[model samples]
Target: MAPSTRRAYATGERSFTCYCQSMNRSPWPASSDLVEDYVTHLFNTGIASSTLSVYLSAIARYHVMHNWPDPTQSARLKAILEGARRMNGVHQDQRLPITPDLLRQLHSRLHLTSNQHIDQRMFGAAFTLAHHFLLRVSEYTSISPARFNPDATLCLDDVHYDRTMLRCTIKQSKTDQRRNGVTLTMQRAESPFVHDVCTGYSEIRRLLYPANFPFFMHASGRFLTRSDVTEALKKCLPDSCDRMRYSSHSFRIGGATAAAADGQPVDAICKKGRWKSASFQRYIRPFPNT
Candidate 1:
């Protein structure tokens, strides 16, 4: 199983165990009626239907792993969940993509100075690389100790420069369970100003770290964390309510949206983003009129 799947199952098991303990019920060999009651309890607590489904899956997986009958497989339990979904609705909030205009604004604000030169250059390169490559924050930065997979992480050696193009090899990812890696290449931006900024950042990165070092680093010499990247990107944007909607995911969403606006085919965008399924459509938002 993938590390992420294991983590989700662990979380779901914990939640179900707590629920069973509170009601003085046995989690193991739970009856369909008990599962229905648990589902109803979760629904009443206002958890989204999607989340409730995960919880149910976890319960089912737990039973299957132990060679026990899964109460979640009952038609009655499915009906309860279906009812909850219809009652609560299933819309999820979509994070706003950081468009090219927003990226330009961010790039312009990262001015290099004597005191903050290192930070400014690092942030600029990280931001530019993320946007151009359509990276998930976790793909580039260490997010949590428990979830970090060294095999999937990017190190300095993974990056190669060939003339004006930068090729980055991602050894593993959420989708790559077998550890077969993928290489994503981005050419120098056509705009001279953008090209210069990207080139400058690469130079700074090379000067500061050895070839084997983590590609993204903090000032203290540790790998950059997801929170660090999020906080830094947030500071680059203007202070506004919309800023709150932008996160590490905004880079991926923005890149897809920008590419679509530029007339790139969906298949090309999927190949660039390493999306295995049509789910990439979720990232392509309609470009707003300026």
Candidate 2:
């Protein structure tokens, strides 16, 4: 929770304290129906579900710490959780990657229709780099312009020019096993479309973020969050499109799907994605109808 959320929780605690004092009674036990009612009140007042979950989890821990004998409280909480789960409804199915034609349509709208000459251009460059180069989102942030050595052959500066042979050392990836690990090297294959995107991203990196800092920083000079990237992609997509269902993780999915379509081996795709085990084969199973 944010500071305001924490403050609201504190205010509720103060009210509970005052109520207990007025009644000349000790704090309510977890088994008390009153505590359960308070949780419902919090939910009714439009508190975020994640915030409420945190508060309830803390309350549960406090009860456990105090050695409260509250079998009834546990039962009540279970019922409340089940009710909330039902009310929230079933989750939507995962949206697959936007096809190449749809992706081109999105690009046209963002590049031509909108007056996004500067920010949108940079945004387009980022996603294009992600989609085309199979670069992990973190790779952009982990790389730094300052890391470009005088030798020019060891860093991003060296290989970015030859699009066919681009390489950068990924220090920590989503699947890196060791606390400290060797760097990952990625090379662009034979697509001209992919080549242009990587070339454009190199230029955009210098234009948007400081050459002295991380490769992908915001206008405020802070490193971009994965959510920030998703929001930008959302804007680039058409209004009629349900691209809000897409996330930064979708970039990886898009890459995997594209590679799979290109007849890349499942093992190779898994290695690129840094999956720990072949169990990810579950995701590769074709839909029954498809």
Candidate 3:
């Protein structure tokens, strides 16, 4: 499991332990009734239905590890989850897509220069790459500067460019379960924007970083976090653009959307995005359904 998964599971365990202590009940081998009441307690505290399920999972994991039956399998507990979910509908924070036009606007506003520790060339390179390659921010950026994984995050060594093409080899992705990696090739784009920004960032990157360091390092000499990416994106939003409606994900969404609007084949879009199934269809939005 990813480190993030382990941390979430640990948090769930802590919540279960605290609730059991307050109720004067044993947390081990939780009875179905106790678990049901626990869900109710969380729901009453304004916990989302989705989070309620995570807490139940923590309780279930404890039982399984101690050679006990999974109390979460109880039909009554499942019914309670279903009822709560129906009562409190799922909330989706659907961010707006950053289409090609919006991307250009973002780039135009940035200050690109060679003297700064970080600047527009960095943002331009990241945005353009994500737009063309359909990358998840996590695949290219460090979640926290202190927690960067050299093997997983995009390092300078993973990229190569020639006069006409760029090739990026990702060591792993969220869906690459076997740890078998992938290499994506992008030809020289018809528009010069992509090539110029990427090569510019590359040149600056080599000057500041050794071959092993991350491609988008921060001015603080740390890896750029997702928060860093979001804040930069928000700052350069075209006037009147709602900052909340756009995020790091906008690049991927916009890339897929732009391709679709241009009449690119669904399969080609899927392949370019490295999507294994039609789930990529959900990535297309604000564009008409066909």
Best by lDDT: 3
lDDT of 3 by residue, 1-290 (tens): 23564476689889987899999998886888888888889888889866776666666666766778878878888788778878888666487778887888788777632345366678778888988888888788885876678778888888888778888888876556445778888777655677767877887788787778787886667777777788888878876787778899889998988888889998889877878777687778783211
lDDT of 1: 0.73
Candidate 2 local Cα displacement, residue 252, angstroms: 1.0
Model 3 lDDT at residue 229: 80
Better of 2 and 3 by lDDT: 3
Candidate 3, residue 100: CA error in Å? 0.5
**Candidate 2 residue lDDT tens string, 1-290:** 22333455566556555555665666556345656665666666666555555565445444554677532345786687567657765344475564455456556766542353554555565566566545556555322322321221122332345645544444444334232333433455555665565566667667664454554444444454455576676766666666656666555556666677778887777766666566344334222211
What digit string (tens of lDDT, one per residue) describes model 1 on residues 1-290? Answer: 34556687788889888999999998887889988898888888999877777777787777766778878878888788778868987675567887888887787776631136766776777777778778877677764522344565666778776557777888766555445788987676544444556566666677777766667665556667677678777777776537667788888898888888898988888887888778688788865432
- lDDT agreement of model 2 with the native: 0.53
Q: Roughly what TM-score does model 2 have, to 2 decimal places?
A: 0.52
Better of 1 and 3 by lDDT: 3
Q: Tell me, what's the RMSD of every candidate? A: 5.5, 10.2, 5.9
**lDDT at residue 266 of model 2 (Cα atoms):** 76
Rank order by lDDT, top first? 3, 1, 2
